[model samples]
Target chain A: MKVKKFLIGLADVFRFIKRFFKEVFYPPFEIKETLRQCFLLGNRSLFLILFTSFLAGIVFTKQSRPSLASFGAESWLPSLVSQAVVRSLGPLITGLICAGKLGSNIGAELASMQVSEQIDAMEVSGTRPYAYLVVSRVLATTLMLPLLVVFADIVALLGSYLMVNGINGTSFTLYFNEVSAVVTYLDIFSSLIKSAFFGFAIGIVGSYAGYHSEKGTTGVGKAANTAVVVSMIFIFVIDLASLQIINLFRVQ
Target chain B: MRTETDIIMPAPSQPRGNAVVEVRHVSKSFGDREVLVDFNLDLFERENLVILGKSGTGKSVAIKIMVGLLKPDSGTVNVLGYDVPTLSTKELNALRLQVGFSFQGSALYDSMTVRENLEFPLKRNLGIYNRSELDEKVMSALKDVGLESASNLSPAELSGGMKKRIGIARTLILNPKIMLYDEPTAGLDPVTSSEINELILSVRDKYNTSSIIITHDISCARETSDRIVGLFDGRNKVEGTFDELKKQNNEELKPFFNY
Candidate 1:
């Protein structure tokens, strides 16, 4: 019974995704609402992303220092840290943070609206709630995630520079020059691409959970929890898939 | 004790105006529970038709079907010359523009101010975008509901009665030909409920809208309905004017009136 329910739910999510694609391209696009959502998703999440990415960069550099010192490779710390931050950590950290933040937000918000009959009210008012609510949110996340990833990448690199300068007095120009030399345009592009996928996953999962939420207060709570968990799972899956795809093109 | 002569038969009177909405032999069920079975109703032009039933009797469902929010399992719903169930998305949306539905909970958008809420349907449905035009229509609707001063307040800040009024105002901004009010006075003190009942009557008079009001509140029906349909056992068991039904005191309608 549980297996059957799970399969049914999975199919429903697919259908929701298909409907989103169909409605998103249709005319009478919600451009103002989409931009408003972009501001909400991006600007509201900026502080948390900055604080967490900064800490992650500092902590990761500190952890790697002793390991590289043991092998007399401490001089290579800038190259290693830059590569990791650009190629993986920046996107992964930002993805997880947004999955927890924006996913729950969209889920609980929409679930509450659903329970309160606001969605029905919108339909009765001759407005397409799916096009207005779901499409704008999904587009916001898709558009904003790449931009957020860029911020996370730059901030993380800055944190690494601060740590390196504190330890070895490495000048800012020298540190950034080495960092830029090691991190190629391909790595930056792939990281951004992965972030966009993660954002799309979070947006759709959260929306699906909220849109199909059962009636009442408990349903709102469940929707929020389900959105966060499902979005995190999707982020990891997309990360693995992107890694495999990127590996195929890497010069061995 | 009411005598047999006092009991009017459950036959509905012929509405004086043309029937604007017609539901025939509609049946709908969810899982194992049947909500409406062979249900039928009609709302005539410029008339206030009340569907009076208990909480679980599918009063809301019947109205939802008329607006194409819910499709009937085996029946036809024709509203404003469009077959509700078979209409395409574009057609259904066009139909919806003519039909304004006021939900039981008011269902105001929490994020928007009262002014924005009233402006939404106008901007989206009618494509009215000029700032002064939006403002004029919004204020007019607010004035109709007697809440023009409360336009800037958030829905959260308004009292329950005020929220309900604003919900009606939002729907009224579009100047719909038909109105479907789902329990216009479900949760309120008697005084507030009376006020909403008055608003319903005034809206009909001012906008000249044909309405179907779903409620279990006997007083609301008595005050607002030009005609009442008593729903029981998933079907309309009786229909008549409130005074006629009150005089009839039929067995099916006794429970509704006795309260």
Candidate 2:
């Protein structure tokens, strides 16, 4: 069973790669349709990501202040907030948000299409259904996620800014300087890379489960649920592996 | 109803036809159970043949093998003269150019408009036609299936029959030389079934493309097929004009024809 599962995954990866290339050049580009999907899958979900980021930012800053103060490091508030937003929270929270929304939605949509025989129809029409359905959505997810992460990070910082000054008034310039001092290029790059992988994972897994879905309505729900859970697990696993690799380069 | 003689011997292969597709002693098994055992078929040019079988009789498997979607364990499938098992991905794709499939369910892309679905083949296979030409082709294909007014609609909005028609339209736009219909009207209402049957006949009459239809619906078989090939177990049970099968007073054949 394990061997069979592995082979299936390998075949699906190869199929998906082939599909992506085939679809990239299939004309009547459907730019308007793709943009509509981005709006539905990306933009519409921004409020949830933004709102969660804000609360997370506020909580992290407030919670860390007392601990830092214990070490006579209360002035590290801006630095701590900035590091949290850039290196960890931004991608993590945004990915979780997408895993819940877009992942489930994509899985359900594809599952229904499979159940309805739409995929087969495309195959018969001399169209590569994999290219038409999976590749476009995966590409959209890949391109839209980094931008969403950027938005989330910005909102998170804004929330942190409010929380930091709420308890003790601090000048905006001082806060800004302290935050910028701690946020290295590595922090930004690592988080961005992680989010892109997260996007890819979400799109591929969701489409796979949905595309191969059977058993009708129950199957649709199962695909959506599996996509969210599996992608979330992948996100955390990838994040941890990345952290260890990044740490390996420097002796802390 | 059309009698058995008219349905049994559909134009008898096709004038040497140069063997467009050949299923040579092909067999398939899933796990321990065998689905098809030593099945052989020859598909020639410009003929419409119907494969009839009960559910689970490997009708779909035969189509998959011919199309190179599934490889047979022990035989050769040659499509347009290219050896299927040995063909490169690019080569298989080239062969696919000559074949069109309408899956058991109408498989229109749920996310795309009917116009987009129809245009995809023209764009993919033909490449780079002007927008007006593409639009004209899409409209003509839709009109071929009596779905011209549904250009902007998505599959979700269309009924089961309409979706199937749109699917046929999409297949037509490709202008494939051979068409495969997998249970084309399995779940449709009776009225819709007749309409689809008419559509299938019209395709053969209008396009002159050789068609292989896999179906369990006897009505569809009786209506559109030039020759009905009965598939039982795995091998062909008996094949002749539909009228022959309908007239066979043999007790075994009686159950199949409900005599």
Candidate 3:
């Protein structure tokens, strides 16, 4: 019975995505609202992403230093950290953070609105709430998450450099030069591609849960929880799938 | 029994050309629980029809079905000459331009202020872009509701009565041809509830629009309705002028009228 319920939920999410695509290009583009969501999703989330990225890079580098030293490859620390952060960890951490922050926020906001009959009010007023509410937020997340990942990557590398300096006194310039050498365009592009999918997943799952929430106020809490859980899982799924695709491209 | 309209009730039901809203043998259900079974109503031009029913009697659901927000399992709901369930989303939205609904909770956009709340329907339904024009409409709506001082106040800041007024104002800004009120006075105090009832009456007289007001407040029904219908179980059990219904002893609607 639980498995049946899960499949039904999955099918509902697909239906939600289909409706999103159908309503996306209709008239009254809602340019202002979409931009407002971009500002909210991107600018508002910047500080948290930066702080997390910094911590991630510092911790990752500090832990890996001993392992590299045991292999007598301490000089290769910069390449390894940069490769790991740029290829996957940067986007993955950022995606998880967004899934927790933006995903939960969207879920709670829309769920409250739905329970209050605000969505129905909008629909009866001849304003397509689906287009104005869901599409704008979804589009913002899709377009902004990749940019946020790129920004997090730079900040994380800087944090990694500081850790390197603490232990071995490597200059910032040499550390960055090593990073640039190791992190290829493919490494950067593929993770960014993954971030976009992660953002898409978060937006859709959040909207679906909130929009269809039952059981009133308790349902709103459930919506927020489901949104974060589903989005976080999808981030890992996308990351794994992107790695395979990137490897195939490298082979080709 | 008084059969005439007065300061409290709206003017007597004026015989109109044709019905603007028509429902026939509508049946709806959620899971095993049936909400509306074989419910029917006809709303004529400029008539203020009040539907008096018990709680959990599917009053809101019937209203939602009329507007195409909820689909009935069986039966026809015709509004403004278009079959409601048959119309596409775009067409339904076009039809919605003429019909306004005031939610029980007001449902004012919590994110927007009073002025922006009124401006939303204008920007979406009519495509009004001129700053001064939008401002004029917004201000006029606020004035209509005697809330000009609250133009910048958010829905969160407003009192319950104020929110209900603003909700009605938001709908009024669109110049809707048909108005539906779902418990406009549900949570309000008697003083505020009567005030809202007067506003409903005044709106009908001012705009000459047909309306269906769903409420349990008998006094409110007395004030705003041109004709009152008693919805028992799932169908219209008794319907007449407020004065006429008051004179007769109705066993089924005894609780509603305090018989």
Candidate 4:
């Protein structure tokens, strides 16, 4: 019975995704609302992403310094830090942070609207709530997450540079030059692509949870919790899948 | 005692006109719970019809079905020449524009101010973008509801009565031909409830809207309804004016009128 319920839920989510794709391309597009959502999702999440990414960059570099110094290869610090920050840590941290922040936000907002009958009001008012609420929000998150990840990468690289310059007095130009030379176009492209998927996953998961939330206040709380948990799980799954696909291309 | 098969038709003495909305043999069930069985209704043009039933008696469900919000398991609902159940998305939306639903909770958008709430249906449904035109209609609707000064206030800032008024104002701004009020007086004190009853009457007089008010509030039904239909066990048990129903004193309806 539990398995049956799970399968039913999975099918419903697939249906929801299919509906989103269909409605998203329809005319009377909610361009204004979508842009507003993008601004809200990006602006609200910027501080948290920057703070955590900077700290991660510094901590990872600090931890790696001793091991590289023992090998008399501490000069390779900039290259190693840049590769790690750009190819993995930057996108991953941003994805997880947004999954927690934006995911819960979308879920709770829509769930509250659902419970309060605001969604119904929108419908009876001759407005398509799905197009206005779900599509716009999902589009905003999908479009903004990649941009946020790029900012995270830049800030993380800067944090790495600060740590390197404090210890070795390396010029800013030299450090950046070394970092750029070692980080390939493919690495940056793959990070961005991964972040985009992460964003799409977070947006869709959060929207589905909230749009189909059960009645009452408890439903709102449950929707928010489901969105965060499900989004985080999806992020890790997407990250793992992205790694395998990137590896396949490298091998080819 | 009224049996399940007992269906009371409207009195012949009461004049009836064209039914702008009609429901026939509508049966709806959620899982094992049967909410409506062979339910039938007719709402004439410009008539104030009240469907009076206690909580959980499918009063709201019947209206929802009429609006195409909830499709019944079986039956036909025709509102304004459109078959509600079979209408396409575009057609359903078109039909919805002519029908304004004021929810029991007032369902005002918390994120928007009262003016914005009123302006939403106009902007989205009617595509009215001209600034002066939007402002004129919004203020007019607010004036009708006697809340012209409260336009700048968010729903969270308003009292329960104020929120209900704003909800009605938002609906009225669209100039819907049919108004469906789901428990307009559900959670208000007696004074507020009576005020809402008066608003219903005034809205009808001014807008000439055909309304179906779903309420268990006896006073609300008495004050606003031109005709009252008693709903018991998901079917219409009695139909008449307030005084007629009180005079009939049908066993099933005695509890409703005794109060």
Per-residue accuracy of model 4 over A99-122 as CA lDDT, tens digit each:
999999999999999999999999
Query: Candidate 2 at residue A27, lDDT?
Result: 64
In TM-score terms, which candidate is top? 3
Point out the higher-scoring one by lDDT: 2 or 3: 3
DockQ value for model 4: 0.86
Question: What does candidate 2's lDDT look like per residue over A1-252, in tens digits?
Answer: 999999998897678667666777876475655676677778768999999999988999899999999999989889988998888899999988998888898899999887876665555444566665787777677677788999999889888889888987877788888988988887888788888888888888788879878757899999999889998898899889888876665454
Runs in model 4 with CA error above 4 Å? Answer: B1-14
The C-alpha TM-scores of every prediction are 0.96, 0.88, 0.97, 0.96
What would the per-residue lDDT of candidate 1 be over residues A80-193, giving only the tens digit for each residue? 999999889999999999999999999999999999999999998889999999999999999999999999988988898899999999999999899988988889899999
**Model 1's CAPRI class?**
high
The TM-score obtained by model 3 is 0.97
C-alpha RMSD of each candidate structure in angstroms: 4.0, 3.8, 2.3, 4.7
Sorted into a CAPRI-style docking class, model 2 comes out as: medium
Q: Which 10-residue window of candidate 4 chain A scores lowest in summed lDDT?
A: A243-252
Show the lowest summed lDDT stretch of 10 residues, model 1 chain A. Answer: A243-252
Model 1 clash pairs are: none
Ordered from best to worst TM-score, the candidate numbers read 3, 4, 1, 2
Give the TM-score of chain A in candidate 4.
Answer: 0.98
Interface CA RMSD, all predictions: 0.6, 2.5, 0.7, 0.6
